[model samples]
Target: MKKSPIETVLGILVILVAVSFVHYAATKIDVRPQDGYTVSAVFLKSGGLESGADVRISGIKVGSVTGLKLTDDYAADITMTIRDNVKLPKDTTASVASDGLMGGKFLLLEPGRAKEKLNDGDKITKTKDFKSLEDMIGDVIFLATDSGDK
Candidate 1:
């Protein structure tokens, strides 16, 4: 059988749309790894944190989580690449935080007041592990019940 002109035009239109999408993805949404300095932080819990997750400081993405591993001591050791321009202090705090109530997790960095700066591959000793929603709810419930009992 032979295809109609309408079918041929429809097929061409679909191909054009696919090409446009590919071009947009390649140019606008960069999937390539960014070049930056690498630092690590160890957490007691990952809470579903993954590689390629955003590393944010003051709600802005300053870097990305490049690697995640379970250390021998059973901690979540996360290696991240931060922008060279964003220098972190030696006492910077790193935490596993969720974007929102039901959003993905990211590595949140809180730069400290130290005059010295963190060097390449330096481990952030001050870290907070991920706290899930359930944990927070349980804490609140415990406090509420304990207050009533008193």
Candidate 2:
């Protein structure tokens, strides 16, 4: 059976749309750091922290930010999903850090020496946020002018 030219064009258009939809869905999915337990941390200030931000250890990405919310006390709570193979110590620290002078934000994890390990839903008690560039510059200026030799 011979198909009409209009039918052929419609079929091609349908296939193109399907392919485009698949590509869009795949790009939106976050498929890194395979399924693992989640840990929570509280920060005085998240400082532009958002879901999908990279979680790193010593500058190496080990996980990603899974969620963010505010606690009853007004502190920001961030949930991170880390790889199953990476077992964080009980005393580990989580801090919000920036990539560089011009880069996005991420979580920095520093493991501490502890016999115990953190379980799912465990909260990291220690955290540090990135300092504003203005604040940093002001501190440097103050130190430079406050020297006794000045």
Query: Candidate 1's error at 68, in angstroms?
Result: 2.0
Q: How close is candidate 2 to the true structure, as a TM-score?
A: 0.74
Lowest lDDT 10-residue stretch of candidate 2? 28-37
Across 8-110, the per-residue lDDT of candidate 2 in tens digits comes to 9999999999999999999987675458889999987788888999899998878889999999999899999998999999999888888787889999999
Runs in model 1 deviating more than 4 A are 148-150
Q: 133 in model 2: Cα distance from truth in Å?
A: 1.4
Give per-residue CA lDDT, model 1, range 1-101, as digits (tens): 99999999999999999999999888987587787899999999889999999999999999999999989998888999999999999999999999798
For candidate 2, what is the lDDT?
0.89
| Residue-level error in angstroms, candidate 1, position 117 | 1.0
**Which prediction has the highest lDDT against the true structure?**
1
